[model samples]
Target chain A: MIRKHGIKLTSVAILIAVLVAWEVLPTALDVPRFIIPTLSDSLAELQRMWANEGLLGHILSTALYTVLGFLIGSLLGAVMGYLLGMSKFWEKVLSPYILALQIAPKVAFAPLFIMWFGYNSMPKLLVTVLIVFFPVLVNVLQAMRTVDRDLVNLARAYNLTRLGIFWKVEMPSTVPNLMAGLRIASTLAVIGVTVGELVGGNTGLGYLISYGGGQANAAMVFNAIILLTVIGFLLYVVLERIEERVLHYLPKAHQ
Target chain B: MALEFRNVSKSFATQGDGELLAVDDVSFRVEEGEFVSVVGPSGCGKSTILSMTAGLYQPTSGEVLVSNVPVTGPNSHVGFMLQKDLLLPWRNIIANIEFGLEARGVPKADRRARAMKELDHCQLSGFENHFPYQLSGGMRQRAALARTLSIDPEIILLDEPFSALDAQTKLLLQNSFAKTIKDAGKTTLLITHDLSEAVLMSDRILVLSERPGQVIAEIKVDLPHRDQPIRRRVLPEVGEYAAQLFKHLKLEEKAA
Candidate 1:
């Protein structure tokens, strides 16, 4: 029991140590608050925003855009991956173009998306979708292609219809791969949304960071960054739980 | 004939290789309600025969027939159990057993009933809700057998079904499998590398040569009261059959 709790205990201890150092070091060293705010000051700033600055609204907006982008991107990626994975002809025909799109830096598209969709949430959503798309596509394709041939042959031997084979064999076999991709995509979705805010978003945690940097309010920037990190961590944990539940039957090696 | 492979030949195209013949003019007939085991060296096209019989592979030449009908596609009357149990990991044992029945459009309740019956028959009554991973190797193989049997296929193809089990489990499962297949009156074509397995379970054993496999010998197993395979293994004739198959396989191995 102690060993099982060891990691969490150590993490908490380290976190407290860091917070203490963050709070004490700046004032002890006579460092300016604007340059490096104390932990207390950042927390206070977070509270103030929560109470009066509509920070909750900003968090909700970012979450919405992130989830929407993640869902759309994952859906499109999975569909495209299924097509490419199942058909060698399509893979051969379209792989080069897909490669080019994947390799191109995503940040470069933010400005272009802004130009097309304007300064509204549309540009941010599009940016997030584009950023989250590739990992899901690549993972899904790899998973589908490498599905156990024996299982597929078993289905064929049973004289399952083409659709039946796909539903009963192909889909279930790809769940692990899809779950892995979705986990990755969820994290990337957060980053994608942040990047969008950094580039052109008007009211999100990303915008707060950008605004705080301009005003040299280190406390505000730290607060926004902390919240963003927490959001990403929570998203990852939830996705992992879903993965665990869905793939409960997977052997230990797979888990 | 419940199943017949008439001068069947199969070749696969390999990377940068012109062609690799796997089965060369192999011919065999499996009578209704008979259990025939094909023993050979690895890569001797033992599985190729089963696949062709299942209609998953079309022969380069000749034909595979089931109940006097040419197998143009996957034969509905055939149930193939692979070396691996190949149970759907996401499904429980009962669900896996019902996979073929579901594909055949059996009603949900009917397939469930059939699956439960097979599970009980396989001595896995309580494991119906358990996943394949939760079961032991022997149990998993029995579950695979139950799944195949649940479909009520006239022809059953077993590819090294008990090869992955422990020696004790193999013997036990083999006995039970022999009894089950006999009771079902299904024509079973088993492919394996184990000579003893062939001698113990088969009414007839077909020994095949190495790659580009062809029948080297066919020996009729005439053990008394063959239904009790584990008991017959103590008899002298089973050893003789095993030795005969070993000799034929060794000859092919040396020739290769």
Candidate 2:
């Protein structure tokens, strides 16, 4: 517990030091606004945009796309992964295509999605879904495959039905891995939405960043970037908390 | 006989090779309520024998019977405890112990009652809600044993179930396990690499030859108090049986 408090203190101290350096360094060096905006300028821009330019609306739009895409992708991936996990023949048959999709860079598809969906939120949501799918599918498949054989055998010895074994053994064992994949996918979902917005969207933090860059308003770009970072951090923290609550029975890694 | 292996043999198919013989023409019988141990050198197919009895493996050649019926597949008549405690990490101690009953589809009330009784018997009454990770190794194994017995199987197969424990814990668990089996009057077959554990726990011990394993000899444990593991370990009779098993295993190893 004391160690945990010490770690928290260290992180806060480091953050403050970084923030001070970011605010002071540009002034000391007399860097141009377009090259290196001061921290104060970014914060002032953030306040101005929040009060007058609908920055909150942009944040909400991006968040909606992210959540929808994450939910659909993770659910569909879990189902597909579970089915493939149980059937080796099917997995062998379909794995190559899944692998191909996984290896092809998702960001490269953002323009194609925008072209197909015609400059709307649909393209961004689809991009987020596509980005979030593979990690979950692969992780769930691997988790199912790696379930301890002894436990399965025990279930069989006790005459557990096929479905019973799946419920009591396979499902619970896959949870930790599934949670790991979801955590990664959540962060990726945010990135995917940002890419989509950069390519074609009219309103979103991603669009704001792109617009700010086009106009050479460095403070506006920094404010948008800061918002994106906060959103990503919050998503990660929520997932982590859920993982902790669900896997409380497991031996902690440090132990 | 509660369990019988009639001229049983098993072989495995190796990749890019012909059949690899595991057990060779092995025959044995475990009488009702008997505690029998099979001790052999490593890779002697001791575990194969247990798996075959549990119907987890087909005997490649001969037959395994339980209660005068030919064994076809996993049935409710037998329980197997593996070397690892194998308590599900997600389950609390009581829940782990109730697994077999749950699998058998016993009523919730009945399952809870049986699990609580077994937990008390294993001396883990207060740890009902503590998960497997929270327990010590000895405690986990005890919970595993309780899980096995919860279903009231007539025959129990133990595959080196205590081999991972420290010497002190091993002796303590063995003494308690022997007494529990005796009190319950269940037929048991134990597979072990440890010679003294066999002598201390078994009413009779079978020594097996090296790979392509077959029964080489049988020694009836003549100790007066078989349930008392610590005392049995110090007994001269225990030493004789252990020495005899060691000598036979050594000879088999040299020949192989």
Per-candidate DockQ versus the true complex? 0.82, 0.86
Model 2: per-residue Cα lDDT at residue B150: 91
- Candidate 2: which stretches are off by over 4 Å? A1-6, B251-256
Best model number under DockQ: 2
Index of the highest-lDDT prediction: 2
Q: Specify the poorest-scoring 10-residue window by lDDT in model 1 chain A.
A: A246-255
lDDT tens readout by residue for model 1, A1-255: 787699899999999999999999999999999999999899899899899879999898888888899999999999889878889899989989999999998768988988888888887888889878898999989888898888888888888887788889998889888998999899899888888998896889988889889989899999988888888888889989888888989778732
lDDT per residue (tens digit) for residues B167-186 in model 2 = 88988999888888888889
Note the Cα lDDT for every prediction shown. Answer: 0.88, 0.90
